[model samples]
Target: MEQPPVTPRSALHTRPKSQGCFLVGKSLKPVVAPIYKKNGIFYAEIFLNWSHIVGERYSRLCRPVRITGDKPNATLYVGASRAVAAEMFYSVPTLLERIHHYFGFQILESMRFVNDFSSPHMASTFSPKKEEAAPQNSEEADASWKGDDITYPPLREALMRFQSYMRKIK
Candidate 1:
């Protein structure tokens, strides 16, 4: 038996100056467009921005399932329950208008309610969330204080109150 000379792994595989694969100056859009068309999710922005498009009320209860057809005649299918579908029936026009307004053009011609589609928050009705107002005390004054980190909760509260008072006097 005879053994051949061994070469370093790095030396065996040399890096090429120009690496070309498949082709250059070619686009993959043609390949991906068919997949998107077949999946019925061509307009991903509609689904991703459903919350902004439909507003808080419907955004929680409804979701964009798929968009069918081409521009000027495209249909948007939304997932909702039977009750939600009925509740949303009258507001379809309003929602469609909002969707169109969101995109700045009429990408969707109509919206169809899909009862077959289901989601976890279908039956939930949520009240508009209230934002808590910031404290009246000056934030700059608090930031201006060069105090060590206080481990005690009560001491921190008292220190915050003292800072508030000092800021008021100044």
Candidate 2:
């Protein structure tokens, strides 16, 4: 009788354990990518990963409070003090770009900063040694246009910071 011919194993067969091939993070990328972000773990709040997006240095001063708008044209709202907001002024462009890259799509259109120094945490992690005098010029704000009126105090402060940011950018 003629010897039977043997066929090679097909892809449908299980891979051998000795092949040095096993499930790795890359293999599960599609399954795990949605959980991990550039700055931190992904929770329900996408902005919670702000620290990862901006960088350690910038994140220490401020944090992303929330994001608003439609899918592709969203805006990020950041919370920080006037000084920190001004410091992060020039970084907006690069930070925005980084944010866009973080989501892996063009979701955020811009950033709206909120100058919130009411809590000591906004300035830094530790409390101040003594009472610090607030700036006198904090009350000054530019004349509002027809649609630019701000009735809220915090909003006014944020607007002033935004103006200062623009000035520094220029």
Report the number of the highest-lDDT candidate.
Answer: 1
In model 2, what lDDT does residue 57 have?
81
The deviation in Å at residue 119 for candidate 2 is 7.5
Structure candidate 2, residue pairs in collision: 39-52
- State candidate 1's TM-score: 0.50
List lDDT for all candidates, in order: 0.76, 0.67
In candidate 2, where is summed lDDT lowest over 10 consecutive residues? 138-147
* Tens-digit lDDT string for candidate 1 (1-170): 98998899998798766755655325767776776775444377777778877899888777888778887698988888888788998998999899888878777888888874455474344435689665567675467564567878888889888887887898
**Candidate 2 per-residue lDDT over residues 43-130, each given as its tens digit:** 2345556678777787777777776666567677878888778878778888878877886766677887897764335545445688
Query: How does candidate 2 score on lDDT?
Result: 0.67
Cα-based RMSD of the predictions, in order? 14.6, 21.5
